[model samples]
Target: MNVPVVTGETTEKHPLEDYLRFDRLPHIWCPGCGLGTVLGAFLRGLLQSGLTPDKVAVVSGIGCTGRSAGYIKLDSFHTTHGRAIAFATGLKLAKPELKVVVFSGDGDLAAIGGNHLIHAGRRNIDLTVLCVNNFNYGMTGGQFGPTTPVAARSTTSRTGNIENPFNMSALAAASGATYVARWTAAQVHQMERSITEALLKRGFSFVEVISPCPTYYGRMNRLPTGLDQMRYYRSNSVVRHGTNPNEVGVGVDGQIVTGKFIDIERPYLPSSGDGNNGG
Candidate 1:
């Protein structure tokens, strides 16, 4: 075997660099955090969706995942806590031509903004929500939030979380989302495909990404590192593409059932007239 020595540094940029803000090269996410992976998948999906960056709007609430809006090279908005969906809804209604996406953490999307989330699905708003569920409030001292797995330890749940976590895919499907899917950060290709599909879907679409919060969530729960959590996902994930959403609920140290749980068309907003868009 002949070996060729190449010592010159390559200056070629990543294909996705064009979709990001170069000025913000160094993001604040912790080492082993999955936000970057999810963001990359979203950007790739956006490119595959055939939508121009100028006509795409990204909205995010306050959290680790919420910072996505700041890095995307689109019309991005860093909205108030638990208000990303509300803001995205208004943007979508005002400019139906624009592709509005709500990118935020589980705490921001399913807790304080729970009402807005369910209503958005109920009204079948024309928006794609990419919720990064790290299973806790990763940005706020690792407190247990609505999606924290039952019996999982958090800052608040020092011993272990008692309440059952919400099945995000199920909630989206039952609430009337036309497209609903769930994937872990490890499933990058699947995540990107789901995102692209959601973007093309006409009615409300929700994609829940199970990410690793190595800094807080993992530290408190004994995972300690992002790799540990990723390993868990790899070993425990079950991909049932057409499984019923209601049958998939995450529990502490339980099998992670992930896939496209729902895909059905529905009338959106003005057409639905459910009047549930009070957010």
Candidate 2:
């Protein structure tokens, strides 16, 4: 189905519009939310990857990011909370020819779906996982989550969060993901490039995207606007490809190390005869 793209400057339909479900316009994201930016990058990445939209399956769990499934004009699945990876795994196994991608938030992917995330990497599943780390549960009234930076304030952590945040890229690399990368929502080009690279990879691939939840996480942490957070990323983020993922933990108002940290070839489950199958 062809849909016309309506930009302020032009009325011509955009190439990317062919990959979006236009009926879901006026997304549920907040005014300053970065999920929209990330979604744009994803769509552009999909277009650049040269993958057929009908052959791609997007799976999303319950969260702000999970809404991606509903918006993308692909074979998509909106799964239960923290189960997007599991559902994607099934989809991939059932139809090994399909390209399975899981798009969800840090809270859902790292907090509850963490086991599936790690196991997918460990098993060398053929999948691409995009985890948007907003530092808090933006959909659920801005609660602290597994990726919340230490000493960062959230609705639950009024004073500050005491728990250490997970270095998701590091975790993915350590779990045997063949491709691992990290980028901020502000770095649209780099994010899109990384996503394209991950999509082309054969084994388990993971990309951790640091985004802003201006309404909740940002408000609680003093970055009241998305532009403020983007400025922070511009100043604090350092691109160091091949840097040790373990040393890239984000802290409260600290430096954000971003880049393609790991890219290596690994055997998929079927090739290894482990009874697993991946493209």
Candidate 3:
């Protein structure tokens, strides 16, 4: 379970081969999708945190981001839709020694799995949750979702979405997550740093990753490409560490706020097992 240092510059063998399931190379993600970038950042963050892959277990619910669990070479699970958190919670209680991470999409985590997401935070479970917010349900025809901003176009809301999106970081913090952060795919290294911090921290931790679903979200909103989405992030992202999560809800073409909004000590949910701290 030795993880290799990836310089990320080599193209021949690819620096991150050790972390990926090469048999599944050439992922199903569409051209210009940003999942690959987010995945790379997660792997690099895990490596940088000095956590051995064998001790880590990734869980995911059904969605485009759910494919993340299948792509990682480490012990993983592809749970039922909106059930990744519930599964991960049970896994943690059964074997608290293993570090469990729930990697899933905003639609799956926020819209369907939202109850589990908040309860896990309320109890301060020893888990790291990475929610990729692509602004729509990318895997299911690109419809408007819980995080779809007001006036944003989607297959279901072509004219414009009138509902307001949830501030995920705020939800996590309010639900009692000990660590909360938000970053875009364009800020890879920063996202990696935040992932590393979340992994190393005890108790519930949540990181909301704003990614590009150029195939759907971008196409409906006029971005049309991953690079265009990245440019949009560059132009709109404002790093405001410690800002109130409640004030950072993204809007249609609004300022993309990014930061680690909360970090505080809390008692993690206790497990029946011995010799394993809740984190």
Candidate 4:
């Protein structure tokens, strides 16, 4: 007999209870959405980073991925749309000792919050940014987003999107981020390891996670299910460490180039008025 997961209340403790909120038992992501898997990977990576739970803070913007802040047990904030990075920057500036992380989707981070993303990278602030890219705005009726691949189909682009998507890792590296990497949800182990490394990195670190919006992008583009997308990723992804990030743009039919593109030591610019060091 299959038992339904009890949402509101239950005595059974989950293995991740230490880092997640039990009260928010069931998440709102769709059946095939990769948010849960991404969240799980993040939690594991957090543990691997060896940072004290209390010393870490998570910030998320308005979007499906924004709900992550509410699910985490540590200090977290659900901020305005496209403002997760801004909020995280503020948190880090106010409390430099804290390890701040911005967790949000492509639309929230790369679209509305695009300027903040770039400026933060330019400053090289000591922060880790985990961007979950589902290729479209899954929450807002599957509209084409900043990371939506060219020629990909979405509700807004019924005939096929014509706009070129932003190569997230490339943008991060160009903006002076000290660490930049890309991975898909299908590559969970590597993704988790990358997240941990980003957390441990001293300067601005960005990790772009290609996730599945099976309910939206998949249906419009023929992937249809999370399994299909994962299979595609596993089969089509090419792991090339140090590949030119600009050449790693993912497309509807092109191979997904994944790996750490940059990891260079940069001065961590403290937000405090007196520092000449680069962050």
Candidate 3: tens digits of C-alpha lDDT, residues 47-112: 888876788999999999999999999999999999899999998888877888999999999989
lDDT of each: 0.88, 0.89, 0.90, 0.89
Clashing pairs in 3: none
Best by lDDT: 3
With a 3 Å backbone cut-off (N, CA, C), the pairs that clash in candidate 1 are: none
TM-score of 2: 0.93
Question: What does the lDDT come to for candidate 3?
Answer: 0.90
Steric clash pairs (candidate 4): 267-278, 267-279, 268-278, 268-279, 269-279
Pairs clashing within candidate 2: 5-13
Where does model 3 exceed 4 Å of error? 1-13, 271-279
Instruction: Give the C-alpha lDDT of model 1.
Output: 0.88
lDDT of 3 at 74: 92
- Expressed as tens digits, the lDDT of each residue in 19-121 for candidate 2 is 8888889899999889989999999997788777678889999999999899999988999999998888887887777888999999899999999999999
TM-score of each: 0.93, 0.93, 0.93, 0.92
Please identify which of the two predictions, 2 or 3, would achieve the higher lDDT against the true structure: 3
For lDDT, candidate 1 versus 3, the one ahead is 3
Which tens-of-lDDT digit does each residue in 1-279 have in candidate 4? 556489887766666889999788788899989999999999999888777778888999988999999999999999899988888887788877788899999999889999999999999988899999998998888999998888889999998899988999999999999999999999999999999999988889999999988999998898999999988999999999999898898889869999999999988756444211222
Q: Which parts of model 4 are misplaced by more than 4 Å?
A: 1-13, 271-279
